[model samples]
Target: MKEVYITKISKFLPNRPISNDEMEDKLGIINGKASKGRRIVLRNNQIKTRYYALDDDGNVTHNNAQLAKEAIEQLFDENFTSSDIDLLSCGTSSPDQILPSHAAMVHGFLKCDNVEINSPSGACCSGMNALKFGFLSVKSGQTNNAIASGSERISSWMKGHIFENEIKHLQALEDNPILAFNKDFLRWMLSDGAGAFLLENEPNGETPLRIEWMEGYSYAHELEACMYAGGDKLENGFLKPWSEYKTSDWSEKSLFAIKQDVKLLSANILKKGVDSLKRALTKHDLKPSEIDYYLPHISSHFFKDKLYQEMVDNGVEIPWENWFMNLSKVGNVGSASIFLMLEELAHSGKLKKGQKILLSVPESSRFSYAYALLTVC
Candidate 1:
């Protein structure tokens, strides 16, 4: 099979910096009197800011098409134009898309008539999934160059009319819709931002990084673990839904051959993923000692420790004390985390040639995605 190369990566984190401290202060004020039952522990600022496409009122943005345009511009700045792109994919949940795919809007706005474009929807993992899909398409001799990127204005997920009850319960949120429930999830644990990459069949010129390989699989049962509004009706191959009769505890759900508990889940999933990667390594004749760095799609600091323990439990060895770090400074950016890590590695000169890299995606309550990508030789 032919190989696909990742030519370059660009990230667009907004100028607005919302640190954990900032969020905590805002939350304390936002939920002051009524959020006694809602609990969240914030990072002592171990996490930092994330970008946003704000409205004129300095609030979270609702114009997704504009954000999409800005993301594309930021990704290819000082480099590409409409003429250079052949395939464009926009993986997003929010876009100025009422009638057409957001990618089509971008294509029309850029006035690039020759390129093929698509908009993929899968929520947080959408951008990463789009990238691997494009990689396979290229490797299968379908396209030569592709642009894969995504943006999330999670701010829009809020609805004023829907939260009237919650606001009524809380005195601090009399003026605004305070996200008390998600505060625990957001704490220093996550942030909001966007990033993109320009993938090519071959990299030349000033391209900072080159692709190696991208592989994926579906754990259907696992997919049924984490889900939302349209979770049960999942018909597309994109999502892993939470089981129809899912209960409160993570363990009660039948993993079948899989065990329960967060630790066991991490160990088991990591073991399976590493086994697949081991097969890939055997096919390529590589080893763990050969991998200089590891980039994991982390969702929580707790899982970070659990993952490390699982690596030891599964007997996978490596020197990753510094390798498996999270972007705690910026929070978790969903599917954008891995790509953002790739951008960071390349720009910081941490992603060197002939290096084997391992990236394990976090548990989405459904499935955990893992991959083994090698740096250009």
Candidate 2:
């Protein structure tokens, strides 16, 4: 197999850091029923600060494709240009437009006429799928140069905070405000960012990472309705388009609306994630003991212990210190998370040449998982 390597990695986050306190205030979460809901999310999730592409009044500042284009531009040097890229795979959950596809828009924005574009839309692990496409294309000699990128504009979701009247109604229905308004919590947890990787078939010199093996898995059938958007799963196991939902409930319908089964996610994410990684290691004939670093794209700190225990149960035995994360610093950038984590780790000056590293991404949406093994070179 032709070896593929990532020559450079870049990340773009909109605006400055916005603290949780600021978000709570700006979203109008005062001493109302939503206040307890906001407090629960802030106290449970370890995110102190996150980046948003929003103005002072909470209006969208940049669209999804623009954020992705900026990140890809940062990857280019004097020797690289849009024309040098033969393939562009864009992964995004928040697309600026649906008809043109985010990747195609990016290709046009970059003014590239000959690049093949593919947008792996949906779910958080969609970004890893985009990277896998680029890696496979280069490794197979189908394309010499490819860029895999993940970008999200989830701050747009924050603009549509649940109305005060609705919050009052939900609070009346349940004693726990968090449980009553679970979807509202996602707005606070997810953030806006873009991360990109430039892949080449041949390594000109020492690079950040050389792709060894990449594998992705999905158990959507088994964990159906665990996480979803665009539609809601009914009690009968059929997804009903939100447009068809009656009762004047605009609260459950929006371009950025997302529904999640928290019970299923908290129960299955770690076990399935660990299993997927173990399978990848076995397929590549790799040993967990040899991995120098483990980079994980996790949305919350609550899952850290669960994943650690899962890894221990699976016999990987990697210490907590070996796993690097940027969730607290960047929040959950959705599809862009893996690339952002990788970028942070590469620039942290901790990795050494010839060291082996593992990158893992687990998505609640569709219950998908991906693992990549790389060597610092």
The TM-scores of all predictions, comma-separated, are: 0.74, 0.91
Give the lDDT of residue 31 in candidate 1: 28
Worst 10 residues of 2 by lDDT: 247-256
What TM-score does model 1 achieve against the real structure?
Answer: 0.74
Best by TM-score: 2
Error of 2 at 153 (Å): 0.3
Which residue runs of candidate 1 sit more than 4 Å off their true CA positions?
A: 24-39, 44-46, 55-58, 61-65, 75-79, 93-99, 158-162, 166-190, 227-286, 322-326, 363-365, 370-372
Residue by residue across 194-274, what tens digits does model 2's lDDT show? 999999977754455899988889887787767666666778767676667664555524423666677878889888888
**lDDT, residue 29, candidate 1:** 38
Worst 10 residues of 1 by lDDT: 251-260
Write model 1 residue lDDT over 1-377, tens digit each, in one string.
55677777777665566654444343233324434322333333244554434433446553554555665665564566767787888776445544688778767766665788777765555776677777777777788778887666544333222334444544443555454333223323434466677777666445334557665554545444433322332335343334544443122221111111233344455555555555555666666677777787765554555556666675665656547554665566665677677777767754555666665554443554546465644
| lDDT top scorer | 2
